[model samples]
Target: MPEADGAGEQVGVGPWSGGSPPDDPRYDPELLAHGDRRNVVDRYRYWTVEAIRADLDARRPPDRHLHVAIENWAHDLNIGSVVRTANAFNAAGVHIVGRRRWNRRGAMVTDRYLHLHHHPDPAAFAAWAAHADDGARLPVVGVDNVPGSVPLEGRELPARCVLLLGQESSGLTPEAQAACDVVVHITQHGSTRSLNAGAAAAVAMHSWALQHA
Candidate 1:
């Protein structure tokens, strides 16, 4: 694993060496020659960006049920981190409600590998979920510590559902809370009032994966 520099930025590795190019169509010629240190797994090293995407798409389980969504009303920097986590978990896709443009620095370029959807607001997102072709309605599960939220532990997160999170400063908006099928809160032992949106998103996604992945 590469170490982060003093500024907390990872130094990328250089190109591969001591070998001739393999004949696999999946490998990117430039990456093979230059080396590939992208945040991808070893299985994807030196693979073309499109090839990786196509392979993941083809191999992805048909029942990929967990979708992650973020309320992006404030251009929240945490949105990028949530995107990165979604990619890590191989989520079906990410939905950004509100601002379309978000800071991608925290994504570390992983957004190129993940499916992203945009909605003008929560209502549009809710409408889409309500109409999903699945026999059961896809639930919009909200993550927050707001009053009346159920504890997340042992809660049966639906297999076909979207995990919704709010912005960094403010939690879910009243409209968003109203839109959720159920709001669940992560149990915390420390003094902090709540987890940041990105961390909350990761925990929520992992919870779903634990139940249904």
Candidate 2:
């Protein structure tokens, strides 16, 4: 296995474009027919769908952390973007709460590397997380810039916690907010009501890594 930098990170492929005609039977037909081209690294290009799935399954970490997104209504274009960010961060898993369908355009096919779980609602995600770990019951942390949110920079983050993100526009639902053990805020200088859901998730995940990767 190739090692990442001291920061516990690995670099993706560059200067490689999606090649190899998808005429091969092993690759995902959907991806082949559609434009799978994106800024993604070269390692994934033209790879068989089953091959990629198997590879991802083998690479999954047993002790890795979790990240969740509350889809709520059909307004989660940020979900795919968040998934892409999660892939860049190499999160243990991604939990999607609410609508099953999301905009894959933003994911840019990085979803191939992520282990995704689905929860019907926020309450369901909370319940699963509560018992997901034997005694630990992975801590649920919400990321938002709301008025009462705690500063993420100074706070201690859990090693195996689940970072929860709300929908792109509405933010977290009441049920999701109530389920979080702590609500964290990402400090910003620019005047805005809130940050983009995908951007917020990336910042939160990186913050967690800085504290306790």
Candidate 3:
């Protein structure tokens, strides 16, 4: 059980189950006995994690196949947040290029619900995206604020495309930039030079969702 806060509300809490366990197989026996506290939807309360994943997989909307890729050379802490955002948007999958290991603290455990693929280098990831099994041959769109980049606003993103982002500090490497079919930048009027990579990813994903999903 989570500890109560100053206001007497449980911290990091989720909905609790009623007296008896559900008859459905999807519900976890243990969770039914001891209240469910996992961060999940109301319909998934008391349900096993695998069961929830299976349900999401079964009902995934057709044509909702946008992929997200991130360069992880620095073991970027932003990767986890990006993964969480990807889960929120129901991305097809997430591709990690450069390093396999990344900081997961910012993900808030959302990575468990997302499909993740890893590639040792950017070229390998680009190749896989180009010749995916489904043959969607998704266009590799790079998200960065580099000069000569086109504004993302009003630009019609591909229905099946991969949004590749770079590390927080370094932005995109030359190789990664070379792999991009089209590079787009998010317009900002604020004083900040750029948004955090994770935040940028969320905006980009939402942009795609608005047009494609």
Candidate 4:
């Protein structure tokens, strides 16, 4: 860079000049091409999307997965929080069952790396999971505090499975409730009837990531 001197002569700019590109590798070129103000960590400052995905693909273990599923009964705010949480956990994908559109405000730009899928109903989610791993038969795990549920800590989660979460006020519906191969619950010490949908989704996703990822 250069600067103009008093006599209009070109002077070289000093090193103190505040202009430098980011050094992170995960940053997408598309983002850089546009400006590179993404919400990703510093490690992914200025890079191309293809470059980041290629790097992750090379380093990620084949069996490591963090799948998050949310039942969008009426487009709740918890859905956005859940998506953000799944992104934090580096989930393999996000399954949204219900309304085709969801609020992206709470995602905080994390949705870029997180894969999202839409399903009209629980059956559709199940169908995708059934053939998830090239027809290898993956389990669809559900999270709820129902009587017949299992403790997430005591069991191991599969790498390629759907972890389903119900709506906020009303948990999973009859059909949705019965579609789980296994249901897990988060231990609550308070008088609340159950945990918030977003909180429960985070806990379940973390537990599953610990076991499988």
Models 1 onward score TM values of 0.89, 0.73, 0.89, 0.80
User: Alpha-carbon error at 149 in model 3, in Å?
Assistant: 1.3
Scored by lDDT, model 4 comes in at 0.73
| Model 1 lDDT tens row, 119-167 | 9998998887887636456789999999999999999988778888998
The alpha-carbon deviation from the true structure for residue 12 of candidate 2, after best TM-score superposition, in angstroms, is: 11
lDDT by candidate, in order shown: 0.83, 0.72, 0.83, 0.73
List candidate 2 stretches off by more than 4 Å: 1-64, 134-136
Residue pairs in candidate 4 whose N, alpha carbon or C atoms collide under 3 angstroms = 24-43, 27-47, 28-48, 28-49, 29-47, 29-48, 29-49
* RMSD to the hidden true structure, all candidates: 2.8, 7.9, 2.9, 9.0
The CA root-mean-square deviation of candidate 1, after full C-alpha superposition on the true structure, stands at 2.8
Q: Select the stronger candidate by lDDT from 1 and 4.
A: 1
> What does candidate 3's lDDT look like per residue over 1-213, in tens digits?
433444656543344445454589997777776666555667777777788778767666656568899999996899988998988887878899998999987776767877889999989998898887377577899999997799999999988888999999999888999999999999999999989998999999999999977
Q: Against the true structure, candidate 3 has what lDDT? A: 0.83
Q: Clashes in candidate 4: how many? A: 7
Choose 2 or 4, whichever is better by TM-score: 4
